[model samples]
Target: MKLKITVLFIAFISSLTIAQTKVGTIDSEYIIGMMPETKKVVEITKSYGAMLDSTFSIRVTDFKVRLEDYKLKEKDMGELEKKTIQKELAGLEQDIKKYQKNGNTLMGLKRDELMRPLYTMLSEAIAFVAKENGYTQILTITGNEFAYIDSKFDITELVLKKLGITIPKG
Candidate 1:
């Protein structure tokens, strides 16, 4: 009787362990990008790009008009006068280039600054969801990797929801 009971208990414990499913997979970038914070980050980047683009447009338009004015005066000007104007225009162009370079650097820094907070939040959310849902492991599927995962085992939607991402109804 004792042997039978011990065997039954071990079998039950093994069955319980076997009953728990282990699942993992890679999520599409498109799906991850739909997170609300990700959308906000994209919007911020677009706004910065638009500002830089408009600034460049205005500067180029002004420079073109200035260049035309200089060309019209070239016939009446001495060599020194023409050289001075050319130097000034060259300096202006250099300034514009510097501005663009600085804008790119600043935009990158700002984007990273903004993303840090969001990343921390997302990490916490993922942890919370993983713990609550008993997710033993969740793997990120990136490019050039084939993870053997069943589509039915994906918990991406649940994780997204835990991160406060709202799923749109089809």
Candidate 2:
């Protein structure tokens, strides 16, 4: 009958639509954590941070020592000498603040510089896995981007495997 043929055609079209859209979810944070390069980046950043801390500490100690010496000698010094020491101490304080601010900025830049390549590699692996598996879209689940996702749709392990990174066995 004409009605039966129309129903069958609609069902076929519905099936085709369902088959074309293959959505998968990936946890980028989880993937990045599993990478060995991440650990190395963290260690390198920590060492750099320690070096900055040491430099800042030395400067602070020098400032403290100079201030204490100035205080002890102030009673015996002329008014001009006291004013000059005060100005010098103020300048040292400003230098310390500037160094702290610049050190934070440098650390952020270094972290981005070191992590960019790793991120690019991860992105490539994800793309490759998506393409190979015929996935139309891969969504990140790391930041609660999706309210609900079936576990079967998660391709995180597949992505890790594609990158030659072994997933840690629980």
Candidate 3:
């Protein structure tokens, strides 16, 4: 009997606590998109990507030239010389493949490096908005997650306003 009474008391208190929880959703990407700083990050990232591509292109060209020269001259060479050129070409091929892979990774690292400060600014704005508005929890979400969400509970504008981002006029 006492266990049943204790369970009911706990349930009542839990309900009260649940009722006080305030959930807020923000599209942080949208806020970041509106920031003037984003343009500079995009430009710098593109330039860095272009630089990587140019270097890769040059490496590939040299590899192709070396392979073509080896193929053309192999008929006249002794077995030992042929083997040495083939091995050198194989090593160059491997280097090219490795450089292509590393180029992609380097691009990602550069983008992340450029965006880190903007993300930090956005995070601070989100924190300030959460505290000021008494939001118990703040979520950065894609709109597709919820079938329906009340606009009043979306704190994107609040965070943007705090960040001093001027919305572009359509």
Candidate 4:
């Protein structure tokens, strides 16, 4: 009789633990896209991209002008002088390529800088909503990696609500 009672107690505890686990999914990207403040971030990112593009364009223009000048003067230049100009032009060409690579990296960094705060805000709101709703785990849906997640378990709308956002009706 005592063994039976102990077994029942253990079974009850296990059931409680299993029942406490509540998993939910949220699409944070959708939440961020819906945010009005994202417009400002987009504008700033575009401006930064344009600045990088212009810098690249100026370097290309400078290289072309120098190449033209070198071509015009190459005939009158001495051996050593010609070699010096050639070396300088080669270095400038390499520098321009390096600038283009660096510009791409800088643009990515700037985008992260702009998006960090919005992600942070969404993270905090998600946490609050999860705790309030007794969620044991929250997953983010990206692409179609998830074979299938029941819509009833999606807490995205709840999270948006927590952040005082309303999902626009289709």
Cα RMSD for candidate 3? 3.6
Q: TM-score for all predictions?
A: 0.69, 0.87, 0.85, 0.91
**Backbone clashes in model 4, listed as residue pairs:** none
Q: Give each model's clash number.
A: 0, 0, 0, 0
Question: Predictions ranked by TM-score, top down?
Answer: 4, 2, 3, 1
Model 4 TM: 0.91
- Model 2: CA > 4 A from native: 1-16
The digit string of per-residue lDDT tens for model 3 on 11-56 reads 9999989987999999988888899999999999999999999999
Per-residue lDDT for 54-97 in model 2, tens only?
99999999999999999899999999999999999999999999
Give the per-residue lDDT of model 4 (tens digit) for 12-131: 999999999999998889999988779999999999999999999999999999999999999999999999999999999999999999999999999999999999999999999999
Please give the RMSD to the true structure for each candidate, in Å.
Answer: 5.3, 2.3, 3.6, 1.6
> Can you give the lDDT of residue 3 in candidate 4?
100
Q: What is the lDDT of candidate 4?
A: 0.93
Query: Residues 1-170, candidate 1, lDDT per residue (tens digit)?
Result: 99999999999999988767555653645445776778889899889889888998898888888999999999999999999999999988998899889888988998888788776766676667667777777676657476366776666787777766777889
Pick by TM-score: which candidate is best? 4
